[model samples]
Target: MAPGYALALAFSVALLVTTDAGNPGLVARITQKGLDYARQQGIIVLKQKLSTLHLPDYSGSYDVGVLGNVDYDINSMVVTDLQLPSSEVTLLPNVGLKLTVSGAYIEIHGKWRVHYLFISSHGDFELKVLGISISVGLSLGSDGSGRPTISTADCSAHISDMQVHFSGGLDWLINLFDDTIASSLRDNLQKQICPLVADAIQNQLEPVLRTLPVTSNIDDVAAIDYSLTGPPIVTAENLDVQLKGEFFERSHRSPPPFSPLPLSIPDDHSLMVYFAVSEYLFNTAGFVYQSAGKLIFNVTDDMIPKDFPVRLNTSSFGKMIPQISKMYPDMLMKLKISSPSAPSLAMKPGNVTISPLLDIQAYAILPNSSLAPLFLLNLSTDAVAKLGVNSSRIVGHLELSSITIALERSDVGPFPVQILSFAVNYYISHILLPEVNDILKNGYPLPLLDHIQLSNLMLKLNEHYLLLGADVQYE
Candidate 1:
């Protein structure tokens, strides 16, 4: 298959197996934060109008005549003191959201122009609106770029009490017709202002969502791609978002055979992420190791005392010597190590295992003559690991619990030396494990989308995948 095609196929397979379902509480928290942020910005403008107004003769205003063909223009409307109570969100079947905004108060300032008797009278008006409520029904879907978007289906707004204050030449006229003016304003606002608010929300929110960094690159070596599969689900308690994607290294190699299948979502979590381990991700590590060739560790004579004594006690080697001293006390030992093959990953309940084959060789000069082989060993170790996530990044640690040494003839000895097993195991446990941990310590940085972070992260491992879940909090 073509490289791009292969990559796409792999991603599809990964998604089929990996299901990253969201938590309702986390969704609600994120939505609330987003709303709070919008309120803080405080610059939404709503322009509405009533084309014409008809009135009978005014009773009090300077012997006014019948008012007909009165046009009204609300030049600008700003919302303040807007509050969203602890309202519930309901997901319309296969659509978007049934949102409720209750106990909201807004202070609006606008200019109203009225045309009456071939004369236009303009006035600056201030309205203190109380007992405001809004209900919106919309569908959440993705745009061309895979960002979440909203399509309004229905919207309605209600205002129980509105105190209107007016200025300019028409001020006294409006005061005289306060009740009529209020009723007209309410009718116009319900028809025009409500829909405008809904549209304004969509316009403000969609762009912000699109700009979020859902996909992230890690140190130019690997990348985590987050692509949405469908629109978010809104429920009475919270919102649920589903994400599917894959992680791949720069090498484009596939993961080893043991890569796990995706796991299921955990129960009652504020936020949950279910991820499948891909062959590409595991093989990438091997490719990087192979490209670096061999790693050499030099032990100088100064590091080891001249009278250093080593003991060998194993079933294979028995007790050969009580203590063996180095013949060439001043010489240095060079240990060369390399991974002969790629590493494989397997997921177990609450842990993951990584197995890699290693080839190790050590050489040192003897007092009598030339350099000699101290030992040569081939082995595979299973490093079981666990991951922890913080606000900034994920951290991992590994423990080598199983080791299998492949016996082979070497110049150093006629039989397999027990000391070689101990040496290789020590190198893997003490040296290799820490190096892997360090790499994991600098793991993928969590993207802060719109100043929101995943907090209190927890992990669970299953037969085929790892599940990461967390609560949502503002940074």
Candidate 2:
């Protein structure tokens, strides 16, 4: 789920809790719903690193007393059956992994060729090895480039049942060499196979894991850096990983927020993300808004229609205003508005409030003169909006809300700016509010990994951080 949607969902839940007598059951239901979604997405399923093992062929030449340096080759050597006990996988927190596979069996059937001093013979061979098991310990580290790396600390293999058979070769010679060949092969395999398997896993699997992308892009808007903070933790049922990074944009760059308190792993959720919303994010947003300046709408006498809410009520400003208006050939007025301060955001039950110090300046154009400021007013307004997602972009919808004007400013002492409350509210509802929403319509996009995405996500707002919970899903 996207963070925008999560924030909205969390707000809804908060509303229920606050308005519905704080029912614990409803909160539990919401959490359970998130968990169910996670399960459906397959985030709860544990993935195994090594699922199958295959050995193609093993061939060598051996010295036989009477046969005088016999050469033998075993073709099509394969093992397809393997098992892993539920308790065999263990995790060492901030460390590595220990895995054990037991009760494995290999039914081997292959062709063998043997060459004597002057004679060559070929035959079929059948062998069954039962009660096979292996135990391996892996250590996690990092390569020179800071990518994850895995190395084998210890490995051992055991074989209990060994049966061998041969056909077509002379019975006497075969019988004489069968026991010796089997014994020598078993000893050599027992000593060498474990290290070879370990090497293959480290060399082949490590690079794939390390190359996994940790950064996410959102077209031309922004890029989120999600580099891993440390190596992943592997346990019996799942793997846990953590990321700590920041967002980057061409026009806006700010230092990351300070780290919040450590997160507690929750058993009910398969995945969790913690975001610390720093002062930098808010300050950067403010800078962007200030740089854009004010929005203006022009009004003309002829533009007013019959249904227009605005009337030419010069009677309120008295006879002098009407006389002054008559002297100007063309009368024009502009309502210029700007938010001088970047909006400060706060969260409540089912709502997010953005309060920005607004600077409203009205202008009038006199004949043959440049636009002049008619009036200047400074006040603060709270714009409430709801979060959502649209076409992969996080958006906000403004709500019909009231605005409060700040009258404590020293410069506006004794002035009746409060009388303009209705006009300010109207302007915000129709214009300023939409502008703020437009700025927020492109909220951060969710991070993704190829075909996988986070499912049924929810966000929780804390004093200093934003907590996200969800499950993984593969397309």
Candidate 3:
């Protein structure tokens, strides 16, 4: 049950939480349907553990009416077959989880030796245990490092019936007292079951929980933080976990400028898990790249297709402002386009938009290989992004909704701002956006637990956040 226990502790550490905007940026919910799957896996693991059980030798002396004093020892008991036909997992609301197993049956083979004063009889025996039942309650919490911790709150095991059959000379005499021997065996078996369960949780499951990566590198430039913001929230139908799903620059771990907005995920049992990501996650990415100075790009004439009507040179600008044709004719030009600040994202019920402030500096090449400053334009735009999940990452493309252009400074003298606006908008729509889209097509990685895969996913845009509902497959 290590895997099942790991899954439970990993996702099951909460109660009703406050709706503070500073609440966890990431929230995941595990429904009853998910618990059912976990229960199935748990039973398989339990059976394997029980099959290797080591029961201590049982030896005792008892007096039988006509047989006088009889002494018997049952040793080297080995489990031959075990069956767990019924089990269930139930959420205990504020208490955590309770697992109950009933109707379990087990068969054991062992050696028995009995002494009756003058003679001793030795042979093999069969022990059948029936109506076995076990119940365990688990309490989940987190350690200082944000890793989940699991401890057994309460546990119990019961054996309703045990029958022993002996085969050997004078075995008939021992059979008459087998009921008394079986009772002692039943008591010993019941005492071992719960302690083994507790040890498995402490020794096997707790270590796996520590292996969860709270922070993982997404790429060379950035890494994501998936640490729990606080303890989990528990409801009758769900176990909710909250995480600080923010990305930071690899070299610098500065916090993002904005805080996560209040996010919520409805109970959807059909899916194994539900992940709700806030706008803060995307904005932190913008901040990381902006702070890293990786958001800037230099566009040259060589990058433009030769067949384009307008070239990136003084000659092309001269068509609009004739003064440029007399000064630097046939000279090439360069545009250094970069964001002055981190772009901000705005999400609403059916739309997700972004506003980025950019500074585009145009320069003309001089005969001496020096750059002659032409003009500078401050650009801002309203763009909407179409998002999709690819593999474990989120991939998206931006669509320009509106553009704003302003002349900040110029060395070639003043020209009508309206004149360059058309060309600027056209350049952005046809050239710059395509390049941005190409990079966005690669997408950013999403934080996920080990060996967990998302399938049958659905993404929904809500006010201030994005909800991703998916069925999870544990490898």
Best by TM-score: 3
Candidate 2 residues 1-475, lDDT tens each? 2212222221121111111111111111113333234333321121122223343466666666765777677676544333333225455545666656566555556677777677777777766665667777778764443345678888888877677788777534555567665665566556655765575566655544565454455334344444545554444444454443333443555532332234333354344322223222333333433343312233333433455354323222113234324433344655445555444555544556555565666545566656655457676555565655422223456564556675433221234666556555655565444443444555554433345455555655544233445554445
- TM-score-sorted candidate list, best first: 3, 1, 2
State the lDDT of candidate 1 residue by residue for 428-461, as single tens digits: 5655555555555555554345765666666565
- List the candidates' TM-scores in order: 0.63, 0.61, 0.87
Better of 1 and 3 by lDDT: 3
Model 2 bad stretches (over 4 Å): 1-71, 76-89, 104-109, 115-120, 126-223, 228-242, 248-337, 347-352, 364-371, 383-400, 406-423, 432-443
> For model 3, how does the per-residue alpha-carbon lDDT over 1-475 read when each residue is reduced to its tens digit?
1111211111111000022247677777778887787677667777877777787887888888876889988898899999999999888887788999999999999988889898999888899999999999988777677766778999999998887889987788788789988888888789888887888778766676676567777556677677776666666889887877776778877777778778767656787777788777767777777787766777788777778767789999899877777788999988887788877777788878777787889999888989988889999888777877754666677788998889999888888877888778877777777766665666655556566677887888878788877776767
Which prediction has more favorable TM-score, 2 or 3?
A: 3
Give per-residue lDDT, candidate 3, residue 457: 78
Quote the positional error of residue 347 for candidate 1 in Å.
Answer: 3.0
- Model 2 RMSD to the real structure? 9.1
Best by lDDT: 3
Q: How close is candidate 1 to the true structure, as a TM-score?
A: 0.63
